[model samples]
Target: KIKNWLSAPDSSRNMNEAYGKLQDGTCSWFFEGEQFSTWKEEPSFLWVKGKGKFLLVSLSSIIHNVDLAKQDSSLSMAYFFFDGRDSQTELQLHHKLIRSLIWQLSYREDHKVPLPLVNLYKKYGHQQPLDRVLRDRSFRWIALQIEELKKCASKNEIQKKLGKLPRGLDETYQRILKGIDRDYWDDTKIFLQFLAFSKRPLKVDELAEVITVDLGSEEGPAFIEDKQYQDPRIVLTRCSSLFLLLYLLNKTSGIIKLSHFSVKEYLLSPMLTKELFMSDAAFTNWVQLWNIDLNIWDQKRSRDKTDVMKMASALYYASLAGIKPTVELLLTNKAEVNAQGGWWGNALQAASAECHRDIVELLLVNKADVNAQGGDYGNALQAASFHGHRDIVELLLQNKAEVNAQGGYHGNALQAASARGYKYNVELLLINEAAVNAEGGYHGNALQAASAEGHRDIVELLLQNKAEVNAQGGEYGNALQAASFHGHRDIVELLLQNKAEVNAQGGEYQNALQAASAGGHRNIVELLLQNKAEVNAQGGYYGNALQAASTGGHRDIVELLLQNKAEVNAQGGYYGNALKAASHWGHRDIVELLLQNKADVNAQGGEYGNALQAASFHGHRDIVELLLVNKAEVNAQGGEYGNALQAASAEGHMDIMELLQEKDAINEDHKEEFSTE
Candidate 1:
């Protein structure tokens, strides 16, 4: 049936659709090329020809028949396909393969399923439906099997049973390792070491670039530009039979990862490292390789070459990795103790950021620069504070690492800790006399960062420490505006209680009331209003609280602002006035409310000229008609498309244009407006 369907002229066999069907049990056959001939020996399995491929089916009947042939056998057969396109699918396939083996082992010709196998089935089977299990891509099946194995009478019995299993990942990996020639063994070992130990996944090109560079050369590291850019494939070729066991090809990104995370776990095992002749020195070398400068000469002539070279060393990576032995080995070999390189800038900073207390202490003991000012967090103090590594922060402080160093992502240690809501770290910094109102980071100051993140305790602490509540600089304007925008009612209340100026205007949303209205925080808007917030204040992103509320389609907030006596025809925001904002967003109800509240339908300003022009431009014919019915000047010329009729015509809204034309809205001036273009 499948073959005939495939051969049909109208056959629409999408690979993804077929795969989905097979997974859902709606399809039992999978298409393959002529290569499927190898499985023809299996009597239970059938292959049928398709247009240019064959459909292979191994259903329940085939499985039952196969079990009958091996009713009394102790050994089970399992087959796995590694070409799965995704991790979830791959894991599900693994479960299916394992289940099949267990199913075969459970069968007996003379009796019911064996007690152990039956118990195993009862424990793991039918608990989670197959569809739900696959959807979640759970590891429950694997965990159940491991638990069953633990119930074996003895370790020897468990080993004996496991010995009968098919060649698994570990065995396959060992086999590949054994097959590699001695000539390429060292290079392969080093390459695998990098994959096994590196903190982040190395890109294929990056791995290739690093491996081809000679790190030991005196003329600094030389980048072999002519080397194969597609080095992952080359590495696989060099490892030969072992490639599949070691690496998993991510088809979407073309980046190769370890076949499974377990592969790295196996490679990192002490016994495997010993067998492969890998040592701390080799690990240090791998770290050194990551830092080698390809453009060494160009960098040397630059202003800060020493700092750059130091930044690109093994000590920084080893410190980042938190590998004490490798770090000690590198330090012993006279690796730059305070080498500045990588993202964190220096070894101390890297160690500090990752909360590697031991390494941080080691670098400090080696007389590493305590106040280095370069990396993402600026110095060790800020790095530790940013990551909430209290012990490391204390250590850096004890070593007199400058607490007020101004640079990196959050500007200073105090702001970094406060921004991340690290109460203890913030207190420690404050105790050490760090500036509470330091102004120069991403969030302007600690108070604003704390307020923006909705950290009430941090905000209170900063306020208590005399931090400026109205410090206007960061992304969100002021503490009150930031808190209001993010819907942090308690924080907003606290700021207000701390004397945050209710009418202060400056940031992205201009004022607290507008920010609150824009974010749809009705309660905050109400709170700001109660605090005597200026409802008609204009400036900032959305102009006024009513306009901001209207732009966001917050009908209740808009109504509240209107009740507070907000200007109905206020003109400043991106959408001109509240009426235009409501019309542009197609909020007919809000438009009705605004129009009933005496909003000017012909108010001309902002991105769209008037409410009619905004409504017509956006293809909101009902809104355009409503505006016109409400006495909007249709012939009014302004905004991007000149007038309402021209705006409708420009957007190809013929129905709206016809309505406008029927009203005689398009005048000679409107015609001239389009003629010039």
Candidate 2:
């Protein structure tokens, strides 16, 4: 059902089709709330009877607009403020906000006043310590306090600064911190958000290196290089602010499985995460799930500088250590696994194809859809097979991968293994009974593959197991054709013993014998002949085995045919005779052999006329003279010797023309003109 929906034409539908929770049109379980009895229909509200929390459930895209995200911020007291942060000015702004919040608390009546706010007022005096203020409130308040602290200029000038600070949470946090006088968020969220970004994980050396930024003293790094800098900490803290949060929530790679194009659109429209975090079971669940954004499967998102910077950071850690929380931090649960149109697909497919085992494993363990179609790459199995990572294949298979999954220039694991001659992988697929004749590339099945590569052991294994004896596919007809085409005599013999079709037709040539003869494989031809393979099978556009042998230059086989009571003057093919083909290819030895076999000399060849004409076309003047000596008619049209003088002059064969002219039997009127007309 998920596959059918994911591969559907409806782009406007919700793309979170890959998630198991979404199995019933919607997955409405949450953490921090009570558990439900069972799956329910589209209920408007969920009552967590134990937790005293009323969960509102809605089905929508997780991605929300940043402009619209402002709505979520409305509930926070310290919402992002548009102002500049200076010591004296921030003091003024803080004093004013303090007065307003204090007035609201003193009234004890402002519905806008939150319970946490009233509680904070009762706990902390009217002038709460700056350190205590930052620690007690939500991130929203911290952001507001940072801004209030950074009101560096007069009210008139604050807007100018806001105009210059850029329009995101990082800048918003930056503005707030510019004048912060209180404590920062707890050190744990700090370490988790920022240190995890570096993937350094607060090593002793790093923890030892601290830099400070004075709230009033925005000097160079040297001002407090040794001290744990407030500014740097703020930088780290603000890195996970709303803008950072959204960026983190939205940054998906090919491995991530996108649930929707817009994070807030897919996640919040339905209040999905709120529900997930509402229930302990949903949050604690360790199930593997894929995010499928079928709605925007083909949409391309232009990555901004932040995206690149984030990716660089992710890749850096990936190269040195391995993918940790970086993939999770950058991409959301709603990000697509097979995200096609970003900078790249989720990180796993890229890493796996490049043989980055660690990343592949990381992604797999993190619930990255192992079977998702990767960007430009077909799927994870294709990647593993192409790289011949036997272990990766094992991992994907363990994850329930489709064995014959098609992808790459040649589709599926079987074809890739066959092409690369990975005998063990071939055996794995064969033992597992992979699609026997799954056509991808020229070698479709394991039999043709083993035979083409002369894997005699593999061929014997496949044949004994009833693998297709003649699975005609791709360029070669089947196992017999591939072996005979490449002249694998041993493999050919084994196939025939297994009842392999001898007269099996193949690419550009009708049968295995024809292919062998065309390639001048004398041993293969002899073996096929011993099996009583057709000597005159005329199924190809190029005609029979005799013609294939003659054109490609095989003298021993030509004699063998004659000795075996083979017809020497079998006139078939575009090229009329065997001798014509031999002379056309300048096989003087073969031509002589054919002549000794009483072959027809005046037979026309493919685009080369008869034997003497074919010889003249190839500039074999010595052979031409030989043909003339054999009572070849000088005026035989289409033969190179037809007009002996004309043929000689065309090739500048002055000596041959002189010899021909010296013979009174040769007419001087036979001009040595090169003109075909």
RMSD to the true structure for each prediction, in A, is 19.0, 29.2
Number of backbone collisions per candidate, in order?
3, 67
TM-score of each: 0.67, 0.47
lDDT of 1 by residue, 519-561 (tens): 7778888899899998899998778889988876778998999
For candidate 2, the 10 contiguous residues with the lowest summed lDDT are 11-20
**What does candidate 2's lDDT look like per residue over 305-380, in tens digits?**
1111122223323322344444554344434334443222445556665466766675666667776764434676
Write down the TM-score for model 1.
Answer: 0.67
